[model samples]
Target: MGTSWSARIVDAPPDSAMAIEAVLNRVIAQMSNWEADSAISRFNAAPVGKWMALPADMMTVLRAGLYMARLSGGAFDPAVGRLVARWGFGPDGLTGLSAAPNHPAPWTAIEVEGDRARRTADVTLDFSGIAKGFAVDAVAMALHDLGATHFLVEIGGELRGQGVKPDLQPWWVDVEAPPGLFLPTLRIALCGLSVATSGDYRNFREVDGTRLSHSIDPKTGAPIANDVASVTVLHESAMLADAWATAIMILGQDRGMALATRQGIAACLMQRTASGGQEYMTPALAAMLE
Candidate 1:
């Protein structure tokens, strides 16, 4: 929610921009940790073991986050908000701390029932990894409801496309690569699909000359220290794509690719190697290329 969003629509209603902004605002109200009154912030401040009623939109994203956490075996955790804050990525800024108490599968402590969710432990919810993607899908749906069909919606870098451009050409986007990396540009059409990528280059902090990525490993309660430069995933749902990208990035190159292949996820991963940047595409992505 800290970044900007844009939409390229064919025959979009003049008022469509306002509608899109309204949808994004709702997501920010419910999910942005930067806002002190956001649903996520309230839930984080809620008394431990007390069930807190949350808006449907927050519930939706929470469910998706928990699902990804389970599917990735804790590689993608929504309960790492405190960890994020400790690293200066959140509202509290950096505390100059190198690490925190590691919790084993902290996401498991959260329980959801109906429109209510509660945490058994002192866990904080952070949707930084997935909320933007959900906002993209939300805006896209809002556009569709406004009778706009041909459009491409993007929040930050995650994107979703539907129908086609006025020229009847598919919405094609070049996959992002880290700067200074020499790799053949790869492009994909996001017709009725969404793509999200998690990379070490997005956000970080330099500690004693070491660049620490914003992506914290739930398993370690610290920033991810891996060779993985980035991992991109494509899904029909932007929310899922966003979560999967984070999950795969946390899993690193080998295990991430293996799990992605096993789950039949279209993913392309790049890692910084001793020689240089190396790219790997899963079978699902290879099939897409073919």
Candidate 2:
């Protein structure tokens, strides 16, 4: 919610323009807290004894989240919601400058039944990582359905683009470094693709000169501390890019790079050095950039 978003549509039909706006409104209805009766809230409110029927959109994200959990070895888990809340990232809220509260295992201990899901362990579901990207994709699809062939849809720093801009150039994106700095940009001819980034510098709290990031490792129920300053991912779906970026950040440099390579995900990692400089992309990611 602390991020900014913008969209530009070129050579779009009038109907398509209206449809794009409608789709964004729907996303707000489903995602904004003011619209508390949305599907996500229902799933969160469902009692332990009963399973909730999730909307198709929610289910889509849940399935992808589970896959990402497996792929990242639980480094990225949406079920870390309870832990997030304990640290003030959740609705109940934070402990200020103090350290985040220790949380129990995530909803990974939960059993999912079709549209219904349950946690064997006590945990809350947090879709913060994937939701924005999912929304971006959804918005892009809405535009596409309306016969808009060229556009970039972005929501809270997550984005998906299709076709060529009016200038006939590929959609170019820049991955920002820590403290909100951007270096060499990555350009992509967004025929139909999405990109997302998650970094510690985005939304965080400072405690005694130490900045505590919102991204938590479900494995340790703690914030990850590594040399990596940021991670950006590119994929067919913004949701995948979003979740994978978080996973790679938690996984850190070597292991994260290996997983990205094995999974065939194009990624870039920026690491901070002791000399106050930054290290650029990993070999695999560099190749993708090329």
lDDT of each: 0.90, 0.74
Which one is best on lDDT?
Answer: 1
TM-score of each: 0.98, 0.88
**Model 1 worst lDDT window (10 residues):** 95-104
Tell me how candidate 1 scores on lDDT. Answer: 0.90
State candidate 2's TM-score.
0.88
RMSD of 2: 2.7
Note the clash tally of each candidate.
Answer: 0, 2
Per-residue CA lDDT of model 1 for 85-147, tens digit only, reads 878898778767755846678898899999999999987999999999999999999999999
Total clashes for model 1: 0
Candidate 2 per-residue lDDT over residues 1-290, each given as its tens digit: 33556778897667765675676666655544334576666566677556766667777787888888888888888777766765667655675434433444465665788776765655666788888888888878877777788888888878888887888987777655566444455555555878888888767877778877888877666677886778888889998999999999989888998888888888888777766545545555567656
User: Model 1 off-target regions past 4 Å?
Assistant: none
